[model samples]
Target: MPDAARPSPNCQSSHNAADPILVPGRTCWRMEKADRVAVIIDAAAYFARIKAAILNARHTVMLIGWDFDTRIKLEPDDPMPGVPNELGDFLSWIVRVRPELTINVLKWDLAILKMPFRGGTPLVLLDWISSRRLRFRLDSAHPPGACHHQKIAIIDDALAFCGGIDMTTDRWDTPDHRDGDPRRVRPNGEAYGPFHDVTTAVDGAAARALGELARERWHRATGEMLIPPPPVPAFWPDDLEPDFRDLPVAIARTDPMADHEGTQKTGKRGVREIEALYLAAIAAARDFIYLESQYFASQKIVGAIIDRLSEPDGPEVVVINPERTPAWVEEESMGSARSLLLQRLHETVANPRFRILAPVTEGGEGIYVHAKVLVVDDRLLRVGSSNINNRSQGLDTECDLAIECAPGERPEVCRSIRSVRTRLMAEHLGVSVEEVERTEEATGSLTATVDRLIRPAGRSLRPLEPQPLTETERRLVEERLLDPDRPEPMAATILRGATVFGDVNRTAWRIGAGVAAAAVVGVGLALLARRNGLGKKMQGE
Candidate 1:
């Protein structure tokens, strides 16, 4: 394990040509400095800290998300009887123990409806709602098919957590990515393949910004305002060590051209800061761009990537995604988008640095790279709920956090960036950070480092082998059945219903989507069994 010592302070200045983070009205809500920030990798670390933060909450506990599951145990192995581990029960228990504490949970209305199918009972939601202290609201404040796709948890306006992981089922997993791990099973005892994800814990001003965002979302959805929590509770988690201290953090958001009532919020159409940031980050990459996302179905993002690759001295670009997109219907859409994008991207980039690969377990079962992260030249690190797809870019409401070190700010910032990238690669390769750092230094290349550490067994990055798409999939991609870049008109969504790579966050998983077998594949039955999945909170925040 790497040293838990807190990292040095992050850069403070603005207007740097190289770094795009903390730029007001461009990349973030505002350039607020966090008293402390810890980038927790994987669900185990993320979830455990959440539990600790909630337990430590005093006045307010606000959870804003696309999906929520009550059946999930906050800390399954390390139970806290005082709070009770199960989510719904835990919230209830917290309110009971602390009479002054009020819990506010705002989940997407449709996602709340899909709770039962994901192994959660309606009674659980009912219980939380019935408890006056535990306020629950199902948010339905978007155009049809548009999602409230932000995954955020703010406790007492002091501590906040935001990233890919949701407080739902099937999200917990370690870096080992072991084959058939018993702990990776669902509530029904069915084991899921290895899962990979991340979230950032923050305190001080940054936490307040997240709290403000959550409260604003709640007001937009429910038309009820929540007074900012009093400065009563403590900031930061006691158990987890801070990775970066007193660093300026940017909170970037993406909203469709619609308002809370599905009307135009801005005259221009929609907020596309997420998209602009992607373009900026890609353009600014001096050495390499490493990205991991749930879907690769955005043509505009691909176009931007292709632009970078076309440069005569373009940096290496490596993409990490799932080996398979899960649902056959989803495969027909997102899978095809990936293959087609890869096909197009390959034609533009002549270097082997432009590679798309999947992380696999010891037995080669794909470790779903649901983490939406982008590392540009190891100087800019973005972690959030925005994926490489168009929906996340503009259709759905998204929030991402970015950290960019002003070029020459601190030697430690560069070291920290390299450390973060190496840590991520080491997790996927099942090796220590020392090995990855040494190998990467020796090879003088991220791709070559991964190549040398790449293994045929255990955890490793495998080249994503694009499969032959069925006729149905090809047609779906052609028709834009799933990957819509902008929020479609409600009329279109109501008349021509379709789907894309939605939420597989929290503890929930997306196995399949509503498939038109007869029309698409000539099959009689719908291959997709469940619809508990919500569009993802991309991990790049």
Candidate 2:
């Protein structure tokens, strides 16, 4: 730790251009047939795609995520050509088979700390990098206290996957979320909830851009410049065909230090590009807006939705989230804040059309919602590492891809978009679309379906109401929010504090010394200024 007070060389430069200029309004950009796109509705699809991309990589593999679990199985039960079922085993195999190739992994440091009991696999990944030609490092150069939260993977720099899904364990689930699938297992064989997420695979300019992002993160984390891998033979896998064609796509990034540093600022002092994008999508909606996210807090976005609902012509909004927060302190604190935000939004929107829900498995095996997605007007779709929360806005850097379908296209395109949401519901209920429709049609809307699913002995996987907080819970929330080390301000003050303090103190002697030193210096400066003013006044008299 060489003067942690000094900013890392990898810190993003504010002097640089804010971001690649986005084309104004919606215009269809033609995509190559080979540059196909697919919307992975949940973790199952996301994992399958990852396995496929890995098997297809002919030269290099680059992975960047908010978190990466070594024990995760990229392909749960399904096997890929020349790959093992477990993620860690598969990576080892890949390195062994292709000694000449390079693999780079980057993840946020804070996310690693979130897993208190886990061993230092991240450090192990870094050590592996030193032993082999591969490169791995923990990214902490983000605004002090901010997290590098983008989840992306680039194979041979020819194909890439970007989305909210992470390459972590307990995220795997098939489109068929069976009632008692033996395949679904957690610590001590505990059953995990059905999860829904979305990721996009592309092989064109978008893919190249994602590769650029991975490379940038790698350089930032490791202080090593990575040369782009040589173009590999069979860059695009044969089986992976284009899901759609000639669709225009946009790649957006969030940095707090970017343009308009006021309302967009996050805890890390980075621009909240994700928040901006969500608001834009909400405003652009003409029909329905469907979204799936792990958490829904952020008053700014909730306020935006309420504003839209107040308008005479607003799009219907549907949200899917986990039935309850994870049984952890962080989840409990953040989840309560999110629930409050949702309640505020509910108060503003009168109609029953705007709904937020969680996916529940039949027989009351709690709904474990863990997807992040935003589909707007049935024309534009966005998926990536962002959760619908304040932290993702500016505090943590996020990358998301948006696809705009060409005008007057087939309903199948819209169906493809809707299928992601429907598929999640189908899996949870363990029922077909026809049966789901027959049972849910009378109820109408996802909320009604959730109500029906909650009925006694109902076989449907429904979205349940969030559990209410108790008096003790409220006190805990206040404690976490007021904690000096991790102040949960409505704005991006958390990032400011993290950055300003830096590494001023290290040893136990300087534990609280930094804060005291800052306060004393501030007071002395104020006193000196007042004394100088009085002296000047006396001289004038």
TM-score of every prediction relative to native: 0.86, 0.74
lDDT string for model 1 (1-541, tens) is 0111111122111123554444677655566888787788899888788888888888899998877888776676777665677787788887888999999888866564465476446777656655567877676556545677889999888888988888887898888777877777676777777889977888888888888888777766656667997786456666788767778888877877443232345555777778878867876776798998998777766766676666666678888888887776567678887776666566546557677888888787888888989998878888888888868887788888888788778767667767878889888887899999899779998788888999988778898755665444554455555667676664564344433223333211222234322223211111121112112111221
Instruction: Give candidate 1 regions above 4 Å deviation.
Output: 1-22, 118-120, 257-268, 470-472, 492-541
lDDT against the true structure, per candidate, is 0.72, 0.59
Model 2 segments more than 4 A misplaced: 1-34, 78-83, 114-127, 186-191, 233-241, 257-269, 406-415, 419-421, 428-541
lDDT of 2 by residue, 204-323 (tens): 666766676677666555555678877665355455555665455676666443333212223344444566677666666655677777776654566666666655656677777776
Most TM-score-accurate candidate: 1
lDDT of 1 at 191: 76
Please report, as a residue range, the 10-residue window in candidate 2 with the lowest summed lDDT: 1-10
After superposing all C-alphas onto the true structure, candidate 2 shows an RMSD in angstroms of: 13.0
